[model samples]
Target chain A: MEQGQTMRGADAVIKVLAAHGTTTVFGYPGGAIMPIYDALYGSEVDHLLSRHEQGAAFAALGYARASGKTGVCFATSGPGATNLVTSLADALLDSIPVVAITGQVASAVVGTDAFQEIDVLGMSLAVTKHSFMVRSIDELVPTLYKAFEVAASGRPGPVLVDIPKDIQLAEMQYQTPLQALETPVVETISNLEQAKQLIRASKAPILYVGGGVGMAGAVEQLRDFAKQTGMPSVATLKGLGAMDKENPLYLGLLGMHGSKAGNLAVQASDLLLVVGARFDDRVTGRLDSFASKAKVVHLDIDAAELGKLRAPDVAITEDLREVLPALSMTLDIEPWKAEVAALKAEHEFNYNHPGSLVFAPRMLRTLADKLPEDSVVSCDVGQHQMWVAQHMWFRRPEDHLSSSGLGTMGFGLPSGIGAQVARPDAKVVVVSGDGSIMMNIQELTTIKRRKLPVKILLLDNQKLGMVKQWQHLFFEERFSETDLSDNPDFVTLASAFDIPGKQISTAEEVEPALDEMLNSEGPYFLHVAIDDAFNVWPLVPPGASNSDMIETLEKE
Target chain B: MMIHALELELHQRPEVLERILRVARHRGFKIIKMNMRSTSDVDATMELEVDSERTVDLLSNQLTKLVDVTQCRVLSSTQTAQTASL
Candidate 1:
């Protein structure tokens, strides 16, 4: 620590990020952020310039999802900062750890509506875990460190820091990383014995796993807890990879598109061991009717989420990593396990369409079987996202990343690039809908330039499939603005980017096309044209409870 | 619903009050009355009356986690703390 040393605020931003062990950042540079880019020129940290600020933000989200680290992004003021709003909201809802840095207008013209001036801090307050608008150069160092801490701490989510231009240019005595601030620790509760007692007393207990298990790095503990208690476990959409798909104790995804067994098990449970999951409306369906038979023991890191939805018989606020193992030490519920097994055997997810048409779910299952064990799949929202969730076999939660909470379109491509960059050794795949692919199609240039070996599987049905299905079921098929019949040939579009691609329109072509894409060297795209009339089954219609989901289309 | 009053002492940084207000709003509490007086160049004391269906402890615990907040406590409440009935 040199006593007389001084550095520009922009340089300090880079230094602080490096000190926090951030190796790469996904972002775009603009007028206000130029000073920071200049500081980044010769730095060891990698700056990946994305095609758009939205892409940069989603890519950082992908990086965070793939590698359990805080993702970083930077953008200039006004439009650049505004572009990141959707990403921030996406991260906030899904609980992804991201730190977004935006350069604001100089302090003098902050409220004068100067060129490229918008209040980034004011706009981002509701969407971020925490936000800081640095008013002085002296506050920069502490604010930077605080931003990282808040983003990565308990119940992780995005945090934003808006640095005005004056602060970036002002030179000040640089300070080292501040003494580690008090991160929110889920206070170690003394209710473990009470929770264990309730578990031991219950006959039909089900372990409900959520995204918090993955965020806490407690995948193994979750599995062990379920096994030791002999309780069947079900996962929310974001909690998909927390348990092995093939594990007998685990049921497939549970929510709007949850499996029959998964939903039925919840209905029959007498005790619900809810771990690391907030019971969202999608999962709960009709709030009043959800898990009506069960007494819940809710465990979460955030106290706010504990009793927000369903009242718990015992609410323990602690990390799942600590809570799961502690409570599972001596539970023996063979009878509950037997009941869960019976339900699983009777109501397992089945894909018997009785036709040769290339069904999206079956195709996804086939692709899942061929993918490498450590492969990462980033999916865009719509029917394809639900199909992948219902079919894909993830060994761990990190293997699958998607905008689960926000359900944002166009998240797959940039997210794939970020995932590939984060884990070079692992295979990366992007599953996107035709509509979603067009949203951020320019990211193909980024993939080509970086030479990332990302496989893009575009499920093209010539329509916004999910919206069309909803219209058919709820609006008497008066589909409005859901048609995309005039879409360009996807393979030709990929070719223009100098990326090799192939299109499959039949069931027979599915396996070979997937194999070709997976085996190919650098970035490859596969356009699979499937039936536009297809609908995701087991849909819980609007206002219907999870238990009342329509298992067959005829019921709708 | 009950009325709860909180007295907070905190470092006077940007968004300090906004952050506290945000938490108050999130906990389904309406700020009925507020009074702020500076304690020092960098510190300030705030008194707030919140209308809430939730308990005072829930609001106080979340407020304690804020970075700028040095201290927060429940000054008074209209109702006695209730035990979990379920």
Candidate 2:
């Protein structure tokens, strides 16, 4: 080998990563990963400088989910690495693909009380699909290839790769793998006859699709199968944008604050074909009553997910992209389409306002209508998210972005940064609750520095609305410690970042506020005050059937 | 035919996940899983269902002493196998 051709461990890591087609990475630089940063300088990978390590991880996640590829992110040792745990857990739960790279202490200094040293691999165990540490420089390329493969394989999820300081400083041959080791599908159910027979035997068929289906690129096949079966189709919040909101057969999102029609359809259905969905609690109001009328037909890529919750009458384990087409070929649903559509129409969402003080739902609808048809909106977990899912119409698929799987509080602001980075052409907005916003408030710096147009709509209810509702329903009407009277002025907070903010109080102000934000040259933050007593509606009581939802509080 | 679990204690930090899975995938451990929780009183348990006892011991003894991790052990499953065993 030529003398100048040789490189150190960190340089090798960068070279190998570039070989794997990584162009963008989000991370922060520090003591342990300085070698990596040096290696990345003047390299192919364009690293987005993040204000915090947590924001970096989430930005990578947003990139991975939107592009359907493995997202790459980097962080320093200890706190830098630990900050990525929440985003990794979020990606793992929802099966979004990401590869988080972290630096570690030197080999000799590992066990000693080394500064900035931490076991990144240990802390992220439950949250990642797979993780690794590069002991020797020779293992760099193989480990990186494996990390990407694990992140993008069947049942996609986050994978973490930790590089030790000594390893990053070592020198070795940097040969990138020509191809990744494809993880073979473990289990499959090819008996289309069984699935078809089960579908044929049931009277009311309800299709429950989750983010898995969307991630599997089975949206078209899922819609076709639902159309052919002539069943009511409902999606989880992560599964939103999979079905058109206006489709006659579409039942809208299901679970807490899920459209009444969608939940009723699930309860009334005799046959439930839950494809690639993990019936999360937010989607299943009452676990016992979810699809009570239906004999479930579970179709998913992961074998472990099959009987995890409700037992399936027919468990067909295979890629939904492949199995769906095969099933559709054998069944004909032209005759039953109209009847299913009519049934779906009955359960549609309705929000007829009676001249209230600040109708939040209408604001969402107006935003939905006014925004560019392809604009993407992500929300933090709260009442506002449910309200948007119910009332806002998403024209394009994969347009609405919210932390549905992990339900992380501070996910919106950072993830909005990611969303903006991923699709610079599309307008990205974040609808956050007062509580949720304060969690990741530091990310405001990211927007200011990057100059990314992420319009933030902060809903200030001065309370933890969702918890308040739960306490009201199950806690004997006692509101408990959910109230939040002392809160930062959002307009002032936005001003701190040198970004403009507007204080909006009524639905009448929504359009003008949106116009001001869009027309503005820089990022804008809008704080809209909402009534505290307003509860997220259409809730299913515990252990009740999907049909039995408490739309409004029982007249006590 | 041994059902064992191990407790791996690393600096309550992130990159340790890579070290654990690296060893697992390297050694070809069939089903290795870990769960995380805030630990003030008890241990953070890392469990593995390996195919052989030698592999289990090697993993447990070698990895338990890693820098950030505090404790590593092999635990047995409480639930008896109902279906045909793997």
Candidate 3:
């Protein structure tokens, strides 16, 4: 290829993707994007055809999250682009880097209500970090490059580029633009000293870790800080695997439906070192009383997040990799550690259930213990999601993928497909509920088409368990539109996709069924049926302080 | 409600103003009066008077983060501004 050699803008799109090292993309084809699909027909870059546009974008999100690379997805105009909004919003809230390219109606007919055309740029502005409508062939290449850069840069997020059909067919000279140099991070010595002084002065300091540690690639630095200070720690939902689960001083997760020990310890702490995590409403129930006594030291990469919800005693918007190491120092907090340990011991989860019914929490714990060293668990939202977060543990932040910020229900199956594609050899499992699995249930064919050796664990309670639980407690037991007693036979459903599966309802069958699922060579589904009587315990009633958590129905 | 005036410098993009106003409105600040002028072909400046009970940083911090916003400053805040008389 010569420097000034010309090619279709569609061809330039694929070339730019290759230049950026995008090996695979997830998408579906429709009317407006045919030209780009034609260009991708025989290219070296592989494309996984998802059943729906939402699935495509979610798979891209899964791929990006698992590999720490920018995930790319494509969709056609109007309906196709509209279907992608949910996943894009998911990526935006969770801060995953995804580049979505949508084909628009030809520029000439764009404003005249052309077929399959809508105001995509206007719709995207609310969901994406930034968006562009490429009006000409000259802007196409530069916009694509900028989309990739913006998606992966500071506080990574999804970026959308809408290219008109005419531009895709028009010829353009392909030239790689010069890369922009990154600005250096400057850390002030005064801020570091003030943070150190706060840490030194506190009698009980706890590290409230979040997803930023993993996003910054600063887990090791955070761990070193924890080890040096001998501080007790707790993790947010997205921050589950950021700390070593084996650390005696690390409380599991702190929030609604959080471990009682974790919530109580946070309430008792004198100083909170909030790292890479916003004080989300879920994480901080009754904001006015959350960690009421703790003096805060907040550190994150985003300057806007520093004082957004909870103002800090010392706010440092520097790289966590640099700041964590600078702030690490030995401390004497033996009594605090002992207190946290006692809380852990007192409120430890009891796997003992009275009947032969299969306990989902214990089953998840067993699965977590049995998982291989290289495994990723993509969980959907609901009761099963909470149980997975509570019972399962991961080796790294990337290993556990959940729709933390958006709490999207259909996230598990497609994200699992993407994770499996990203890590071919790593065992990827999708933990979905009866309600959540139906949201993206069409993805089963995607697994069969690609022969991805992914595993599915469907926890079935025949109800929208989370909402039903809320209704049971808060709405006088009016379980309106929450019952799903007509759920299809899950094992037979798996067989329809040429996937082997087994249904287990009793405690006696749990272990053997799990073994069979794990041992299968191809995709396998294990559907576990449990009674809907159980609910997520230790819930802090909405707007209640963390200290006011209700342990069970009797306690409430 | 308190009244605050904001000064902003932005890169000249077709939808740049929409981006700024969207953030301001979403963050609970209502723009009561506004003015804009082209500083150059590639740059533009805007003056905005907004009314909100929330702290101005809540809006200014978010406005500063938009990709097209080059600069943002709070000019003044007043407590006695009448909402209906504006």
Candidate 4:
């Protein structure tokens, strides 16, 4: 197996993917990519043919997030390759390991403006974690394998490999995957002792957990660390599943759209242990005001992220799963527990509001309560996304999937399909806004055709709810272009695709609607008309610090 | 702000320059000047002068992490003239 064997570049591509333990791939085939598809003809790997290249890319992303493995996707050159750009950017921002393989024009006509020729490698530069344009026969095998290595390694992200048609057809002496070993990422804790000292000396310490905790498989470690240290933790949207909701020391998600207590705790803390989470702008509204009182200890696998935004008092660059338990054993903080408990009680998520208007948050909470504990909810970006984040109960990080960093709309349907494929036993649901569901509404056809049991929960406010809330709050209710009152009847739309669906408008209909969606054995769509006046609470206004997060807006 | 000079050894691959520059731009470091010399058919040496309000060690550390970059180091302050000549 260590010896080199002769094979076509296209065959080598398939071999490399299989060697990396890839069980499935999402792709669409075309002229330039014919050879690769031809090579895949007799292979045991399952290749899902999506309706669009974008859908394929997003499905791959969802598969990666759900399975905790590098997702593989393939597309032809030009439009097919270009369509993957959005998902690539989304994957890069969210740090999902996705390997996107694209076909290109023949090597001879690469720069000659050949039909369907585009510089895919050049276009994907900004979005991909790394990219390789296979120029030679020998480069194909190593490059493809390297793409997997880089995509799944430290601070995982999307990687691209563009192979010209000629190269795919070319014969090459390929080295076995075992012979070409991936460069192993060595973990080094630069300042572990110093980080422990900071954690021990603080009276009021908070664990600021992020998506990295989940990516690094450190959720258990984080829980153990928090439990032992008596440190109340607040998670980012991506960090939702990292901490158990039942844990008393666990505060709800922090930052913009965070719980009132979570933001306040971060603002009040003396020591902020930032584990696996970058201080994104959304997490720290006005940078200076966020955690201004806290001495920071930032630990991440990526060294570049250490001092990129907020400088840490102690920075430890190491895998979270390793660093967390090591530091947890050194902690002895019993005095901080009661103070954190008090803050949790003070800033609890209040579901009770004064009106009979159907609150979106309450509806989502009810749905979450009714659903199975292992249910995976894919959410599109909007008020609904924030609502789900604030209310949904997730037992694990991958249970709730959102385009958090890229804030990409139309991510729900495709991601739901991918999640269902990845976890067949778990119930898969997509929570989308009326405005957002329309972005990739066509995926409904894909869902129906694939026979995937995906439940679609549509919160229709008849407007771009989040944007409308912003316009109402920040722009004095000018309401410019945010309204979607003229939207088509979603039930009818779902019916056209032969997916069973229902529409609900009142609070009484909420439970039954959720039951219908959950009880059904196949695809179901539930469209709930929510109150347009409802906005995600505990929102840190733009340019304001996390400390200035407003729990509710004043009546107009 | 200080003018920091760094020497980087990189793989001669497509868009390598843009990727390196992107990392610098992301860190809010401004590129004052840059020169690339092909040391071999596969390897290249890049001399960069960056204007930054951060420590040179930080930038060097990040640069070295790039997949294309095999080696990166911040030169002494006296080496600014040598980079200017490049």
Candidate 5:
């Protein structure tokens, strides 16, 4: 057989991936996976050589999250595949699309002790959305195709495809899948009569939107539903950018460190129409008190979340893509829109007013204004992260990426790199807290090495701000071990990595600092110092109802 | 076929690693790959894999005084297995 005509398994894998527009792959080469890497030499797909297998997985995660595409990562078996477990689990929990392919031991050495051998399939079962072990080399193309389809569709998450070493070397003819991949449809319980009854009976109706709204690509439907129902909608951190923040109905993010107006609106609401969001702890401060007066109706794709927490009065376990359209058709909410406008006139989420200084919230809100439409914002997990979710509004789908599930601290920088790589034309911004940035500060080298055009805004409070807030509120003011005044300057550190860095303190410097970083031609960092003693307000004491949020220390 | 508990503390430097393996070498032991942690940080934990049971006894008498190891012991994995059998 001619080398060019014969469809080798390695080349077939690339072709299948390329068909899905998987132009980029993150991986490291190893002895066991030499055949795949060797075949990749002539392919057009851009393969990023990651420093480690775990980094590759995380980078893939970042890419998928930013682009809403199935991210791919390749690794050799044994230790290489094992290293991907943590990142895989992270992606799985967050519903991020990741497809991990690992080259396993040779077919002859199956179940026998061989060099660089591992049971990759058995190890990844608990973490992945789906997993497969390829024995027949002929099945590789179909399996890879299936993996991408499963990963990208319906509650997207990481999937694993473990192929033995011999499978890569084996030749096969490429036969394209006959039909489009069919994903299982989750049905919504559209109790139209009940929905009408709930809408009619309620005095104050509010929409609690979540991350699934973006995943469903139902923003327009949600906007129309909001216009019809006249409900002031609040998004969870995961659902931050699903609706326009400037919209009158949009009430910003609801959770701990959430907007004061959003938190209060939920407390006052009589009917909560939750769309595509689980009532996570951050959203439901005091779980019992969350939307205390409201008759809750939750619409979600995952059935497990329907009655999970803050149990919904009418749970619709279906995609918001389908449910929102139904809501718009079943009822006319024009009169309710006036009532929602009336409610908005009474309550506001944006804490900023004229002459207000550039506080973290205002800074984020300004950045949101500065960001081009469809710009993706990735944030590290902290008080700053919550502020971004609440205050930094987004205008496009999947425009906001954060490790909401794992709540990993040092996720912003590398994730920003991944996001930028995924969509180089779309501007990427990473809003990271000082404490969170230090966890994987070494990744600064990775960003510099790639010369990715990513903008990083470091919120410098010089404290583990979240922990200290809890300490002040619950631990009798004893802020044990969560302060950071002694650490080296991050701006100075950024310079060492050859990335241009700036330090800004006053409000006068913030805009100029932002302008400088934005125009710096490549990767840049802006560090802004705010007061360490500043506490994130509207905190609900653990185990308290969400409505029972203790606003400021004086409220106690 | 007796299950033994083995504990190997990987050193940062290769020469230090060479020096530390003497205790294992003098007593004669082979490690199993499945039950070990090899970190990218260069320091990791290793289990005996096969016959991890008498590993502590072999290292305890002459090796405790060997100058660099901070701590070594018969960990709870051995005890847990024994309890499981009972």
Candidate 6:
């Protein structure tokens, strides 16, 4: 390549991705996006073809979440682009850094109801952090750079770049644009002093952690703060691995399906040192009664989140890495710690079931204990998701990838594929339910194609367990379309994709089957049949305070 | 209903107005009146009068997050305003 060489816009798109160190992208090719796919043909950048565009985008999200790098995905116009909306929205809510490139119709035919053309930029406005429709070839390179920047910048989220067919075909001179350096925002000393004063003055202060800690790479600082303050802590669903789970004072997850000890501690706390977390409705059951006695000291990178739901006594919208270290101080509150410990002991999870049928929670706990240090658990939504959150422990926030904000059903398999692609040597596992596995089950072929050593643990209740539970409790047992009793034989289905699997229903087979799944060289699915009578316990009924959680209706 | 007036400076783009209005509507602020003029080829200024029971900071804070919005400020806010008879 010469200094002033002209290349196709599509070629420049691939070049820009390589320039940003994007080694692998997940996407599906189509009519409008064929040019970019053509450019990706022999380039250094590799593309993993997904069965569906939605799967491709979710895989990109999993890659980004796993590696802390901006994930890239590609799609064509109309249906291809529409399929990406849910994943993009998921990324936006969870604040994952992803850049989705969609190929639009030719510029002249954009608004004339052209074939395979939809208003992608217009459609993207609600789902993405920012979006661009390249009107000319000259703006192609710069727009790609900007897209990457916006995706990875402050409070990162997904960004979309819609390129018209004409722009991809046009030739343009290749030149690297000057990059702009972003100035970091520094916290004020006065705000730090004010927050410290609140922490020092309180006798029952607790640390409320969220996903932002890992997103900001401030997990170490947060751990230090928790250690120094000696404060009991409760984590949101996304905040699970930010704090060391081994810490006695760390009372696992807090919120809807949270531990009784965790929710009670929050309700009784006098001060909440909220770090990198929002007061989401799910976390704050009835906003007026949630932490009714606690004064909040909120810290996050996004200003809008500071006072979005619960107004803070001291709001610091600076990087958590700086703020957490600055506010670390030894506290003189031992009585509160003892009380929280008592609560934890009083409400510990019981694993004593009389039946011979396999127990999902107990099985998940066993699976967690057997997982190696270098393992990632990607789970789908519903009863299995909550069970994983309750039973499994993670080494870091990246080690546990669940669609926290969106709670999308078909997230586990594709995300597991992306995680395996990102960390080739890691023991990546997908924990999905009978209802969720079928959503993106086509990706089993992806694992076979790559021969990736990813493991699948499918818990089969033969029904949409979560929905059926809700129907029993709230809707008078008028179960509406939640049954999945006729589910296909999962082992046979996996075998069709050249992946070996086994099905087990007895409690006696749990341990050996888990060991078999974990030790297998290639992909293996372990489908365990469980009773639908089991439901996620300790649920904070809708519109009720977190402290008013329904313990359980039917005893196992 | 409460009436609030806001002043905003935005980057000149084809869809900047749509972005601002969409955010305002989504955040529970209704645009009652709006005036806009180009400050330059690349910049535009808008004065928006909105009606909402929610506080002005809620709308201003969200509006400030938009990439196209350069600056957003609350000009005035008044409670006890009657609903517009449009």
Best by DockQ: 6
Against the native complex, each candidate's DockQ, computed on alpha carbons, is: 0.26, 0.08, 0.72, 0.51, 0.01, 0.74
Docking class of 6: medium
lDDT of 5 by residue, A212-274 (tens): 888888888888787766667888777777777667767676777665667777788788988
The second chain of candidate 1 has a TM-score of 0.87
Model 3 TM: 0.98
Give the clash count for model 4: 0
Docking class of 1: acceptable
Worst 10 residues of 4 chain B by lDDT: B77-86
- What are the runs in model 5 whose C-alpha is more than 4 Å off? A1-5, A107-118, A180-190, A317-319, A329-358, A477-481, A554-556, B1-86
Q: Which of candidates 1 and 2 is the stronger one according to DockQ?
A: 1
Residue A191 miss distance in model 6 (angstroms):
0.6
Worst 10 residues of 3 chain A by lDDT: A181-190
TM-score-better candidate, 2 vs 3? 3
Sort by DockQ, top down from the best: 6, 3, 4, 1, 2, 5
Model 5, residue pairs in steric clash: A228-A333, A230-A337, A286-A544, A286-A545, A286-A546, A289-A545, B4-B52, B4-B53, B5-B52, B5-B53
Candidate 6 at residue A171, lDDT? 94
Report residue A298 deviation for candidate 1 (angstroms).
1.2
DockQ of predicted model 6: 0.74
- Residue A509 error for model 3, in Å? 1.1
Query: At residue A362, what lDDT does model 1 achieve?
Result: 87
Off by over 4 Å in 2: A1-5, A178-189, A329-348, A554-556, B1-86
Superposition error at B14 for model 3 (Å):
1.5
lDDT-superior candidate, 3 or 5: 3
Per-residue CA lDDT of candidate 1, range A1-556, in tens? 4433688899889988888888899899998888999999999899888999999999999999999989999999999999999999999999999999999988989999999999888788778888899988888999888888889887899999999988999998887854755556556656888998888888888888889899989999988876666778889988999987668968888889988888888988889988888898888899888889899999888876767778889988776777887898555667767877888898866766666668888889988899887799999999999999998889888889988888899899998888999999888999999999999999998887788899999999999999999898989989999999999989999999889999888887878888999999998999998888778878888788777878777532
- Chain A (alone) TM-scores for all candidate structures: 0.97, 0.93, 0.98, 0.96, 0.89, 0.98
**Tens-digit lDDT track for model 2 on A1-556?**
1223577888877776676676678899999999999999988888888888988888887776666667789999999998899999998887888989899998788868699877776676667887787776777878887787768877888988888888888877656556735556535547678988887766567778788777888888877776665566888887887876555778777876777777766776777788888777767766776776678888877765666567777887677877887766333454444555665566554556655456788788877888886577878888888888887877544677777778888888887788777777878888899999988788898888888888898888999988887888899879888889899888998999988888988766768887887666668898999888777777777766667777788442
- The CA lDDT at A187 in model 6 is 40
Q: What lDDT is obtained when candidate 1 is compared to the true structure? A: 0.87
lDDT of 3 at A120: 95
- Candidate 5: residue A28 Cα off by (Å): 2.7
TM-score of chain B of each: 0.87, 0.61, 0.92, 0.83, 0.47, 0.92
